[model samples]
Target: MKVSTIEPAQPLDHLAPAGRIGVVALATDFNIEQDLRRMLPGDTQIFTSRVRNYNPLTIENLRSMAPGISAAADTILPGTQLDAIIYGCTSGTVAIGSERIAELIHQSCPGVPVTNPVTAAVAAFRQLGARRISILTPYTEQVNCEVAELFQRHGFEVLNIAGFGFEDDTAMTFISPVDIVNAAKNVCDAQADLLFVSCTALRASVVLDEIEAQLGKPVVSSNQALTWHSLQLLGYPAPVSGYGSLLQQLPV
Candidate 1:
């Protein structure tokens, strides 16, 4: 073998990836993983970290998941750089606060962009030109009220909010799509320009297209918007169809 000491005329072409995004998913979450897989481009890679979560999905229980987030994120391809990290629970993000979650995740992975369902939902609503949004949730009234207030605080008009009246976090995942669609119809209003399905555990994307077609407006869901916004933060906001209108219309 002959070895050349001189430098090559052209440096080797660098290999770049589409992007790498992270999700700090709850241990009990059953849908976020699949939903993200369906929406993200084939070139993009996802890394997950499942944090501990308790039943009832109370403010207290939701907040308790925060401590495990940093450690969970640390496990996703250790020593590898990430483009963005998403705290994947919608209500949990509200209970814990997006800024605070971002602050906590950044404690271990500094300077990386962080987002949650709440922040991403708001951004999705904006991108879809929806100011008056009808909110549908699988939570009880209390959590719905808190989330309504949270959305209003961020300047979205909550035309109506209807919950399935469930408090069990794991059970929310079991609620049939038929029941969710019914609850959405109950909350759907003429004054509302958009419909929002909250909760990462609830299977909203299964009926996302049907709901949007029936209501003649856009429908944004927890996992759907989370993946879209996470991709947006990584500068890959191209149109993705069949999941929802948010991803199909939003541009980078």
Candidate 2:
């Protein structure tokens, strides 16, 4: 598993030469487009679809809207030439369950590869050889507990779990990168093999390097893990840096 760092590359000189990625977002308030613009290669084109007012940070909301969100994603992604499509909601993926969501995306896009953030996180944990995980999020207690249960059901041990008790998914984007690092440190423990900062709205990538150094362990965030996984599925090696050990160490 050789990891590559994200460095300055040649900018896209042609408008239509690069591949396109479609992301179907569950929440209207997330700033994923802005953050991904900074992280992804300049050659890639990103397209987004937003589900109106849907929030996965709450268990009741997540449970109520999983099907609708998946259906919305399916409906919004057709007729586009997407190399891949990613479901941008981590908890939504978990709430609906990965296999079902993957099935829906495949049914919608036919041959195109489909991915979700939660599936990516699980893959990242496995690739990092992490068995005991410390989970952190900007979700309510119910959502956080559900996330822990989801992980445990998937065979990973949740050594610890904590969250910021935020019910507003969109408001999570305002949490600064420094605060994200601090929150991770607050919930992380020596018993855990990895720290999972679970939220796409938070600017986890901006502080991944610092957090990994402080914890001396791999730190994975929803967006970072999904980005890494999405690239891998697109047949590109993980070649990004300034994040953390997961991105630094390529998945096997």
Candidate 3:
């Protein structure tokens, strides 16, 4: 009997085709992954990273937690084969400093582009021609102050900032989308060209479209901006609709 020989598959061929992005999220979060999948295009995949929680979401805790988060990214990335990675926390990135967080992730995964939500938010603001931004957050006063300083250092004007003063990060995730939209309407200034609903935990994405329509300006949330930026970094110009003006109309 003659037997046909089967050819062995190449190592790279066995792996699934790499998408444009990889997102590393906090461990104790809400359904950020599910939300991302629902919001992003089918071609993009988000990878979550495990990191320890240092409560209060303060700057000191963020600084203390950077190594663990970076290490988590390093551990999860090699197997996934992603084009770019996003550190998926707005407050975490702001507290740690966007440049510092990006550098750390880059050091861990060389040649892999790293972006943070804070940096992405700033970039989105610039891209959308926003000069004055109204900020909303679910952080304590201290953390909010740090974010304001970080944005100021990056050269964007902060017209107003409001925080819900919630100390727990997980609890922030339960905030209603309608509440976020109402807060934006109340805090946003007519002079401000953009509204920034800051916090990965907050459910800002659900109400982004409504807020933008009501205010007649671009509305950006932590996860939305990061996802868009991550996709852009991966060289995928995914046209996202029904989210906000930033996603629907802004150029990648």
**Maximum-TM-score candidate:** 1
lDDT of candidates 1 onward, in order:
0.86, 0.77, 0.79
Estimate, for each residue in 1-252, the C-alpha lDDT of model 3 and write its tens digit.
998998778554433243646667777678567667777777666767767767777778777878786687777657556688878788888767777877777776777888878888988998898888889998888888888888988898998899989887789898887888788999998899888999888888888888888998889988888777766776665578877877764346
Give candidate 1's total backbone clashes. 0
Q: Lowest-lDDT window of 10 residues in candidate 1?
A: 11-20
| Residue range 135-195, candidate 2, lDDT tens digits | 9988888888889999999899999899888887878888887788888889998899999
What overall lDDT, based on C-alpha atoms, would model 3 receive against the true structure?
0.79
Q: Model 3, poorest ten-residue lDDT window? A: 11-20
**TM-score, per-candidate, Cα-based:** 0.91, 0.86, 0.89
Taking the tens digit of each residue's C-alpha lDDT, what string does model 1 give over 1-252?
A: 997798789978533277888889989888888878877888787889899988887788888888888888888777889889888899899899988898889888998999899999999988888889889998888888899999999998898898888888778889999987777777889899899999998888888888887888888999899878877887874777887788886566
Any runs in candidate 1 off by more than 4 Å, and if so which?
Answer: 1-16
**What does candidate 2 score on TM?**
0.86
Model 3, residue 202: C-alpha shift (Å): 0.8
**Judged by lDDT relative to the true structure, which candidate is superior, 1 or 2?**
1
Candidate with better TM-score, 1 vs 2: 1
Full candidate order by TM-score, most accurate first: 1, 3, 2
| Model 2 RMSD, rounded to 1 decimal | 8.9
